[model samples]
Target: MSENWRLDPDRALPADAEIRKQARAIYDEIASLPLVSMHGHVDVDLFAANKPFRNPADLLIVPDHYLVRMLVSQGYTPAELGVPFTDNGGTVAGAEASDVETDSRVIWRRFCENWRLFRGTPTRYWLEHEFAEVFGLSAPPSAENADDLYDELTAALARPEFRPLALLDSMNVEILATTDSALAELDSHAELARTLGPDRIVPTFRPDSLLHVRHQSWAKEIAQLAEVSGIATDDYAGYIRALEQRRRAFVAAGARATDHGHVSADTTPLARTEAERIYTAALRGEATAAEADAFSAHMLFEMARMSTDDGLVMQLHPGVLRNHNARIHEKYGADKGFDIPTRVEFTRSLQPMLEEFGLSHDFRCIVFTTDETVYSRELAPLAGAYPSLRLGAPWWFLDSPEQMRRFRESAIETAGFYNTSGFVDDTRAFASIPARHDLARRIDAGYLGKLVAEGRLGPDEACETAIDLTYNLPRHAYARHERNA
Candidate 1:
């Protein structure tokens, strides 16, 4: 048997023996709770189609950027990683050439050979966890058992328990909210809501098109919005009405919040005259670069106002330098894990929107950042002071265990637990949701144990906090509280 290298409870413990035991116990208490995935990109079609997943490669390697990116960084071309060459064929193109090896044995051999590349990473941990927990694989994957394990996993996947909905049930997911664009029909979400009930499957509103002035699809996106809302997209007033119309449709489709992924958090609330002039230029597709930015900023402020009135929570994730690699972007398109972090200034950038809506009880805004420097300096303080503001959990590049711990330590001091919205698994890999949540829970419990050992919080309070952090906080954070409250 290849020796298994699983992380034990004591792996992250402090040097002190007594303190380590207490931390281990606390971590175990909440580690098995049902996962709450508040944000993610798992295709709703997975459930709506109700089709069995075809093979191990398609399910495990293709849809995940983490797996593909890591492999790419190790000098494996994306095509070799089974990420589509064409957007649709991207995932399966490599698999065809790979299939010429014909035997599942060959496929497993290749994967086993590359196993060492993932050591000591969260992806490794999650992959191992899934293999053991989901597929009953105890022997570590290597050359010897590669064919055996592949055949075994392939058989297991053919079982009904491996169905997407069945996997959700097995993971004990209370809810799974898929992010959908404003222009999307949400038919899949609707189908799942009907079959699984509205409470189990919900849609998150992601209106990224509204923030893009330079995208090729801007004019068409606006026209589509107008069509959805039965309004014209030619003028400023009509655009606002069209956006409003789309927001209502999203709500009807079971959205509780709107997600904005702007390059920065600059929420410039320009005057009506300025906005109208900018809008006119945008409609002509002749806006100056500065005018385009102004229009997007103005829309951010308007989005906040709409959130206040319509009761959809607002979430802003800023400072991603998207499409940083032009050639790669052209070939592979966006979200190939090429986006990098940039310095973010939330205090000044978000001031305009916060001034208008931050104090309103009706508005609920959760802000996310890739720039961790802003956690203590800007995000925590703003969320601490503003009634509507809540800091989103550590996200994207910062979702590691160390980063999660640092976030809680840095932000909890100023913003406290309540001011920070709870964990969101924010992943494209559906199976990793449970693993991600488990990692977060372990880290949070470890942090809470430190507080208890230091006498900052009593044991009972620490236990309660653990439960809230693991389960309750997410339910509350993503709930339609503004509508209900």
Candidate 2:
């Protein structure tokens, strides 16, 4: 094994020599193309401030749920990994809160000591790429060299060239989008537009809180939405109007799409009278769990209706049971990596919305799922038939190399290439953006190469498909937002 932490030139490519050669050729064609990050959780304030990263631990470990969650699973507590606790009045127990690690070097040492835990994981690939390519680290992280690597990263972060916006430019990211709450004023995004051009950073409207009426925060979010839009949300019609107003505001502020993270793909709209009754019951805190589900389904359909009217692309990814661990959620809040996938059915769930707008030329919807089985069984056929529907790239847990290859294999037979939306990093870690996209491009190249080697596709056609997957698809999918920008 190599002693140094170095990335192989043909990493993640096919193992067969002939296929690898062809894949390398395809990868070279699109290696330096500008990135189109159309969906992610990176805070827009990172660009608005243009501040240097504080330290190695903060930059690499603290904010990333993927890293933190994996470490916690390996018997390391969040406090040990330098994750901040929620500001509650002594709610969590001793083991969860006692003697939290405060020094960045201490937290970094813990990470280096546990480096072997991530050996075959995609997290390791991304971290190693950031270490060697971004920070010029030649040696692999270990307990003995943890301090040295920390000093090196700290010094690198202190440089003005390593600031967030500078790193975005260095990474060749042309268009980046941040997920924003429905009630968000997008003041930071507005400032970013003036400073960095409107196309550089766009906001994606996410209304998950408003849709899940059973959630404890639904009423509060509705109040905030009413406050922001200056419209009454006491009735169903007024609430819909308020949401429409906010969507228009997002559009004016350079938003290209609206994202839904519902637990199911259900879009069955309820009758108007029934929906209004549910709305009133939800306001009175009298809704049953079933009623909440019904209301949420109807709201999703309503969102599709609004998208058709306003020309905003709709992006829906369902079947995630968010905050699966109640203890972790109470102590650390959401996105601490406790979300797990559930099986999802799309054909029947999405029928009502698709029947209404699937044939509309002006409307577009991209469907994503953690349930890989549905890719071939349901999502592929749906996207292939519906003009508005497009298959989103393998997302979240399925973002690995093997899963991505499986996605292409399964979806292409039915949906073909054009019916699929291109890659979106869907990341909160700023530095991992390029690494994730690079991995996707390499995997696509290998898939295309295999097809060419098997006499399934001509070399010319495979190369064109590679370019479309890397650059053209995302650009065209998001062209409407860019035009409005």
Candidate 3:
């Protein structure tokens, strides 16, 4: 049995000779295009600080939920892998809560030894590409070479050119839009923009935290928003004014879009009086869960209206049942790889808002779903009809190569290419950016190549579409061109 693996150039392409050759040609044409990461969750401070990555586990293992979730699925305690649990501080010995591992080497060892758990996964493909292309590793990580690889990565990271900003420059990133909360100060964004110009590093406004009235942090976020935006928030109108003011601030800091992550796609509106009543109840810490849902849905409709006025692209990602394992969440905090995908309905859920602004010149909405079942039935038909809507690339659980191919086969017949938002990395793991984009480019090229081999599209046209998908589409979808216009 082989413990080591190497990435083949034709990986993620078709198996047939003619199709593979055509795919390679298409991929090669756009392989050198600078990545336009229109939307992501990367820490903007990583660039602003310009710090060198400290160690192998820190760079590859700690920040990646993909790797963490897999290892955790295999019955590994997150503590065993050095993942920090929720830091509430009192530890009962022999309990998982207080068992945070401090030694980085131990975590690296655990990850390398069980590396096979990542097989047949996008996490594996990304690691292969990172190991081979990014880090120049001759072989895959394993228990035997783990120590040696760690030493090598530590040494490489110490070099001046391996700093975060330098790595981004070397990766040929044309632009990177990071998600920032509505209450953020944006000091880091400003600093980074000065380092690489306004186009290279930008922010995306995310206000979901402040939108849900029943959330534990909702009132706190609203107060912070009022302080941040210099607006009074004693009522719903002022609260909205504070949010709108925050959006304006984000745009001034180079944000081109606003991100909303909800459990459902519903955007139904409530009357003004009902919205005000819900807001007051929420501020008083008495809003019911059902009332909170109605208020959140109304805020979504309001956000769409705000986008129509302000020209910020609206990105909606719904249908994630976050923190399914209450036990894990209680000990490890939220976003600890326990989030699961649920089916989402876009046609009905979005009809209320779409009927108002579906064809508006200033409005654009990009909708993402983990529900692959809707790609053909609801998402495709909706995007095909509404000038305001575009289908987001397959995300979260559906971002693997096979799933990506399935997405193309499912949506292309109805939504086609331009009706989609192109490929969105939507990742928080910073180093994985290039590998993710490369994987997407290859998958898209393979799909187009099959079309060419079947006489549905010409070779030249395939190349053009490849370029469009790689560079042009994202830039257009995210409104990067009109940053100051």
Q: Pick the candidate with the highest lDDT.
A: 2
Candidate 3, lDDT over the whole model: 0.88
Q: Model 2: per-residue lDDT, tens digit, 1-485?
A: 13466679999999999999989999999899999999999988888888899899988999888888888999998878888777566436554455567799999999999899888888888888888887777588898889989988898999988999999989999999999999999999989998888789999999999988889799999999899999999998899999999999999998899999999899999999999999999999999999999999999999999988888899999999999998778777788888999999999999999999989877889999999999999999999999899999998999999999999999999999999999999999999999999999999999999999999999889999999999999988877743354
Candidate 2 weakest ten by summed lDDT? 90-99
Instruction: Give one digit per residue, the lDDT tens place, for model 1 in 114-166.
Output: 88888877787678777876667657677777777777778888899989999
Better of 1 and 2 by TM-score: 2
Candidate 1 vs candidate 3, lDDT winner: 3
Cα lDDT for residue 484, candidate 2: 53
lDDT of 3 by residue, 1-485 (tens): 24354678899999989999999999999998999998888889888888888788888898889999899889888777777777556553336454777688889989989988888999998888888788777578899988877877788889987898888888888899999989999999988777678888899999998999877678778888889999999898899899889988988888899999999889999999999999999989999999999988999999999998778999999999998988777677777788989878888889999999998877899999898999999999999999999999998889999889999999989988999998999888888999999999999999999999999999999999999988888888987424346
TM-score of each: 0.93, 0.97, 0.96
lDDT to native, each model: 0.80, 0.90, 0.88
Backbone clashes in candidate 1 total: 4
Candidate 2 lDDT (Cα, whole model)? 0.90
The local lDDT score (0 to 100) that residue 87 gets in candidate 3 is 52
User: How should the candidates be ordered by TM-score, best one leading?
Assistant: 2, 3, 1
Clashes of each: 4, 0, 0
